[model samples]
Target chain A: MGRVVVDVMPKPEILDPQGKAVAGSLPRLGFGQFVGVRQGKRFELEVEGDVTQEHLDAAREAGVQVLSNPVIEDVVAVYADTAAVQA
Target chain B: MGRVVVDVMPKPEILDPQGKAVAGSLPRLGFGQFVGVRQGKRFELEVEGDVTQEHLDAAREAGVQVLSNPVIEDVVAVYADTAAVQA
Candidate 1:
C-alpha cells in the first residue's frame, strides 16, 4: 500500500481565529519568542496499493474535495512512499 | 526568524469520527481505491530567531500545552528551518 499526505491550510486572505488566538497567547504563556502561529490540517490517505500515477491523482482529488474546504483553505498532497520522505 | 512544525494526531487507540467519515465518503465520491483516511492537525510555529535548542524545546512545550490535548493526541515537533524541510 501507498500513503499520501495532504496538508490543508487557510488561505492567506482568510483570518484564522484559532491561529491568531494562539499567536496572542504564546507571549502570555512565556513563549514570547515565537512570532506567530498558523494552524492547519494534515490528512494521511492510505490506499491499498503500491505507488502509481493514478493513485497520486486520486489522492490529490480526494484531498481537494474531502480534506479541505476550497472556499477557505488550500491543499497540497505528497507521495509519502518516496525515499525522500522516509529519510 | 525560525520555524518549527508540530504534527498532532489522534492516538491509535482513539476513534476518530472525522477520519472515519472521510474514509467512508471517499468511495462514494468515486475514490474507492483509498483504504482509509486518518486526519490530524499541523501547526506552523514561527519564531523570531534562528532555530536553537532552546527554541525547539519551547516549541515542543507550546505544542503540548496549546496545540494538542495530551490525553488523546500524539505530537511530534520538528525544526522546519533546515533544508531538508524546505526542499
Candidate 2:
C-alpha cells in the first residue's frame, strides 16, 4: 500500500484561536522556549498500489479542493509518505 | 527562528469519524483511488533561536504531555521543519 500525506494550515492572515491558546499555556507549563504555535491538519490517504505521479496529482487536487478551505486555510503540502510505502 | 513540528494521530483502534467522512466523499469527488483516510493534527511551535537537541527534547515532552491525549491519540512525530528554519 502507498500513502499520501497532506498538510493544511490556516492562512497567515487568518486568526487561529486554538494555536493562540496553546502558545499562551506553554510558558506556564514550563516550556517557555516556544514563542508561537500554529495548529493545522495532517491527513494520510491510503491507496492500494505503489504511488505514482497520477496518484500524487489526484491527492494534490483533493488536498486543495476537498481537504482544505481556501477561504481561510492553505494546502501546505501534498506528497507521498515514503516510510508508509515501505511499511 | 526555528519551528518544531509535532504530529499527532488517533490510535489505530480508535474511531475517526472525520476521516471516514473524508473517505466517503472522495469517490463522489472523483478521487476514488484512495482506499482509506486518517485525519490528524500538526503543530508548529516557533522558537526564538536555532533548533537544538534540548529544544527538540522539550518539544517531544510537550507533544506527548500537552499536544496529544495519551488515551486516544499518539504523538507520531516530533521534528524540526527544516524549510521553516530556513525561511
lDDT by residue (A1-87, candidate 1, tens digit) is: 577777788876789898999899999889888887888998877776566788888777877887789999987435564422221
The superposed Cα distance between candidate 2 and the true structure at residue B36, in angstroms, equals 0.3
How many backbone collisions does model 1 have?
0
DockQ score, prediction 1? 0.71
Measured against the true chain A, the candidates' chain A TM-scores are 0.79, 0.93
lDDT of 2 by residue, A1-87 (tens): 999999999998899999999999999999999999999999999999888999999998999999999999999888888775533
The per-residue C-alpha lDDT of model 2 at residue B74 equals 95
DockQ of each: 0.71, 0.89
Per-residue CA lDDT of candidate 2, range B1-87, in tens?
999899999998899999999999999999999999999999999998888988999999999889999999999888888875534
Task: Extract clashing residue pairs from model 2.
Answer: none
